[model samples]
Target: MYCYPPHPVRGHPCDNISGNYGTWQANAIQREVVVVGGGAAGLSAARTLIRNGVKNIALLEAQDYLGGRVKTHRQDGILTEDGAEWIHGGSANRLYGLARRMGVLSPRVPDSSYAWSAKTETGRNADPAGYDAAETLYEICERNSVLSQYSDFGYGKCYADKFSGEYRRNRGRRSERAAWLHFLEMWVNKDTGLDDWRDQSARDADHFTDWGLDQWDQWRAGYDALVAHLKKDIPAGTISMSSPVCKIFWDQGDKGQVLVVTQSGVSYLADHALITASVGHLKERQDSLFEPALPRAYRDALAVTELGLADKVQLGWRSSWWGEPHYNLNIIFTNDIQGEKSWLKGIMEFLTIHNQSNMLQAFVPGEYARKMEALPEETVKRHLLSFLADVTGKSIPEPSFFRRTQWQKNVWMRGSYNSYVTVEGGNTIMRSRQPLAQAVEKNGKPVLLWAGEHTHTTRYGTVDGAMDTGEREAYKIIDYMDATFG
Candidate 1:
């Protein structure tokens, strides 16, 4: 249940043995634990350690601000969430519980709403053919037994195989089938942030346990409020912002103290270190970031664990264009069917920000999201405007203000969140969640630990998962400290 260093020691060597070992002890910048990353996991770890009475700790964050991907941006008078927006499990969720305690929980919105965009019509009301397709897809989602049959296949492939066969048998037309496929793809993309359903695992897709029917809730004050609440009890100067860790040197000469060096050249020596960096960041910098390099098993795990992109483009309008207030406007672009040549393939759902009348947020997932990140700001804005015009069948005015999240471009966070890519008979996620090392050292010395959403198998890609992992790593460090000092 807990992990600790192998060799037990009394009080910290720097505190008790400083006078005896002056040369080494005096020069070392000592800490009981060092947490890398200031996101949900890092903050949760810090809170856990502080609650457990561990005082000497440092939290280093690559970004200037806390809350890794749970960021909120304000444009004009409206507030828009650029990163995480929903508390997925409502009251039953751990993050939701924290939000309730913090008094930031908002009213629950509908899980989702649907709309169809065709050549002649574009609105919530769908034609008979479109309605049938939507209903069929909904049935597929609700029927877990049906989905379980294709556990070994890619979700997209399986759906296509089954749905296509059914449509053909029912005398469905080509255009109607295309409409169904488009809707299904958009739905899948919205849920998993994967552009192609083929990239998702059929088994893993159905593995997620829905906490409740009305599980989605937004924060009234914003996600930053939760971050601040988590840090409320933490000692001042505990977190170092704009401090990106460059290298971690563990199991150093003899005494085995771990050294963490940031990009700015500051070094920290700690008995144990918890690395809560996003999997994307780790994937990007794994080779050169660690002094001795990560183990081959860890490397292999990282390779198999896929990180995905889900970028948001927030538009602030002078007036509301949507007909009514809905949780989300599911845009099924069926009119412009260029097969593989369409640029609108990745654009899926448009979310209505809570109480922000003038704000509408569009999500771009998968490879299209990556491509969107590379395009110039003006170009992206133009493309979105044109798409909206086409969907609404009315000329739309340029937004009063616009902003997009470039998670992939951010050196600190390479993608929005973790995604499951099917690998034949492989449980890459479970393997990746394993401890980086039993105790971070072969000789019972403390070294490095990992915590992130990617490290939580059941709740991967959720805020609660990140918070849970942070607390888990914190407990590991606490146990290590207790065993070492006893």
Candidate 2:
């Protein structure tokens, strides 16, 4: 049987820095920069700072481990992931180069062939042609732009508005535009857990460039190896986990020294601090108390930025039932056959990895991801098994082991990484997410900086995005320091 970690309670289980109350006494350490979150973004920022000879730095992570979203688990002789499973893209991913350099990347993944099966509306095996349709839809999306598809947020303006007369006429004949739009929505739903892509601003989708599309790799060692590699260079004590930063006392009344206070009362004073916490973590208005409060722009942005949800469910069977030890399997459009009426069915995409030994996983996104997080173990297992049997038309026995992650409820993450359309007052708020790029000066001194995947307009919601953002933040700080102190 695969042993899992003790279930965590909301806000407390992995609170590493919470117990060290003595560290909160307003340490008089003169640090140049303090990086928070210790995830890929923060760790990358800290590493860059160290490489640049900025020794007066500190990192804070809320979890016990360094890798934030990249986590690997081993169960029932099957390697699994509680967080990130695949590297997402191949050579196009910036992390790809870094991973290869660090020897944590695999150039060729094992033969993981996916067999997609969808159900008809009647709970019967849908036409085998459904996969072909899905394949055609994927090709169309790749050929056309997502931004141009649903130009008007759900019927505001028809697709005709964005096309020429001839093209518009052709699209209008069979309402192909609307049909194509539905396929696009399905694509987004399965890929990133974003539902109703029409609601997302076209501009947000406009700037998207998928670097992971070229080649993809899955790490058997868990995506966390990237985090491990990041920490290997930094001194062990530089990063502190289990510390929930409660209040940040920055630019005390404009000229006062900046102080960061954790829930346990540890305070770290620094000349400047990079707040790299997730956008969701900052949602609970009362959770992070900012002394003197954040700027109006930041407050506005925080209120409008939407945090999307993504969750993973891994099941380990006692014996290899699929009869293949190394093949990646995926079942798409299973809902069409199961006749299921649940929100999760909309975003269910299963990908199998982990030594392929009867271990399978379902990548649930959006509302379904949220629901799965709240389900009982047995209930979740039964539902998954039943669905699998229907798709394969075979009675697949129950999985001996079960593990599911409720990332939406995870205090550290709150929600999965998603690039949302800037909502009402979102533009002003997005500026606050930027790192030193939007540095504010107080009495001829800049006291605050920001950096995280959310802050990057171009590279948001991927490992490469986080890495590039971290690197950018480091350069911004370095440039500012050089110009000011030099």
Candidate 3:
């Protein structure tokens, strides 16, 4: 998807290039391996392959820039993350470990009661206990014991069946308890990126190994820093940006060569090909992109899995009107029905950007994410500023910087978050992604390999998960080369 520019950065030059190992210019393009996608997984694979002595590599990136969903934009001198915001898990997270090495894993600002305030859409202070009460039910829903029975149904079913009762028992207002529950659902919806949580597989939800709190740490410097780190080991000329793959002929020629065709009409032939495109792109392009068509197993996996949509918006001010520097304004709308084009209702919360007191950011979930993107930038800004004014009773000033992301609308990406097991899929989360992870062999040689967060069983929907998949596939190629070519 995204990658470092083909041209070298001044400090990081691409030199000592080593390649052309395959016969007949490696069947034309002279590549022993062709990596299709330059996101974390693709870049990791390229670096690992080069380190392991397979230097005849060509990495094709669809986007002009690197970091696929890990993009960041400059907002009044602050790095506003458009995709990945936090470093999930603790020391167990590989990215977290990298951050530790980079000396950037340390928290920038402390999170506390002073950091957050809750309010309803009517500009009234929502009861803090209502949120706590919702959180109590949320923790219950997270428990394995709660959703075990609904394994075949959904995590939504468990919440639907029990949340209202929990609300009533916790002394929540009967008239407005439903609104609070909706707020809780929206918060959780951003987790999996589903408008209807009922579509999520309850049984498979717990398959992911919980390292710790999903946001145990974050990159206040911006996630692009990590992308820069991943590409340091790769040779300069190895990456080719503005190269979106069109067709993949995996089992090609007598020697089992793989031919990768890009939209630019350039074809790269290699002994092996590693594809790390997002599942959203794959699901959208699978039928047309793969030659000889994907196998029944992969097709089934793609068909059943869900890659959802999420959007982000950031606003930065030269001066501050908001009281607290780290204020997290949590909005819970009591309105049961959504107004026409009322996508602003989809915003779960707006928090002061970490370490950037002049900035605030918000995330939109599900269909509303797409809807928000369709509106004019000015329209979106007006609604947001008006709402903040109404809630806080302060005249809001124009932001010095304002930006929003359209992850759902990007053709190369198709969605924001990673894939998940669907209740309708009738397979475990692992079972769904496992088939796609397997290499497609020709005459016992790996001709095609898959790597992405979607291909990871336990670590899907994480940056480390994506990098791990890339490393996993790179080793598969390494082992194959050692056994065959060596």
Q: Pick the candidate with the highest TM-score.
A: 3
Q: Would you list the clashing residue pairs of candidate 1?
A: none
Sorted on TM-score, highest at the top, how do the candidates line up?
3, 1, 2
Count of steric clashes across candidates, in order? 0, 13, 2
lDDT by candidate, in order shown: 0.70, 0.60, 0.77
What lDDT tens digits, residue by residue, belong to model 2 across residues 270-326? 777777777767555323356576665555555556566667777777776766655
RMSD (Å) per prediction: 7.5, 7.0, 6.8
Q: Model 1: C-alpha RMSD to truth?
A: 7.5
- Specify the highest-lDDT model's number: 3
Best-to-worst ranking by lDDT: 3, 1, 2
Compute the lDDT for candidate 3. 0.77
Q: Return the TM-score for each candidate structure.
A: 0.85, 0.81, 0.91
Model 2 alpha-carbon miss at residue 211, Å: 2.2
lDDT of 3 by residue, 93-143 (tens): 787878888977757455563467788876788767667776776677777
Cα deviation of 236 in candidate 3 (Å)?
A: 0.6
lDDT by residue for model 1 over 297-377, one digit each (tens)? Answer: 666666655677888888877777765555355555556645332545676556666777566887778777887788888
